[model samples]
Target: MVERIDAPAVGAPDPELKNSPIFDESDWDELSLDLELESGVCYFNDRSYAIGEFVCSGDELLRCEERGVWIREGACHD
Candidate 1:
């Protein structure tokens, strides 16, 4: 199942890959990194991110750290 969430804009969709273009589970194996997340902020690397984690989205970087989802300026959006 894919989680419903927007891709943070901090990383700018990797610039290499288009956000609209999606891949299947099988293609995930081809990627050296674990960009296998269905939703929520993620990267093209072999690592996983947890909810309530820092993510940049909506053309801006959002921090989901201890303060929870928020704008870079520390605004609580979550």
Candidate 2:
């Protein structure tokens, strides 16, 4: 299941990934130190996130137990 939230801009679609490409090759395995409010934000390795936490670019989908908030990104795959 997926949820939608208002963001600063509409996200572009990526047919190859079957979801919007949040991260590119460079973003792979990078730590998600902070939330992204814009589309196309990437989260890499060992990055901890939380739910209910607003991102600077995108929306939060998964909640992090330690952070006490939701993990957020620019776009999501439904």
Tens digit per residue, CA lDDT, model 1, 34-68: 44334554332223344454454444434332211
TM-score of 1: 0.23
Model 2 error, position 45 (Å)? 26
Question: Would you estimate the TM-scores of all the predictions?
Answer: 0.23, 0.19
List runs of model 2 lying over 4 Å from the truth.
Answer: 10-78
lDDT of 2 by residue, 4-37 (tens): 6433222333344332223333444463757533
Model 1 whole-model lDDT (C-alpha atoms): 0.38
Backbone clash tally (model 2) = 17
**Residues forming the 10-long window of minimal summed lDDT in candidate 1:** 67-76
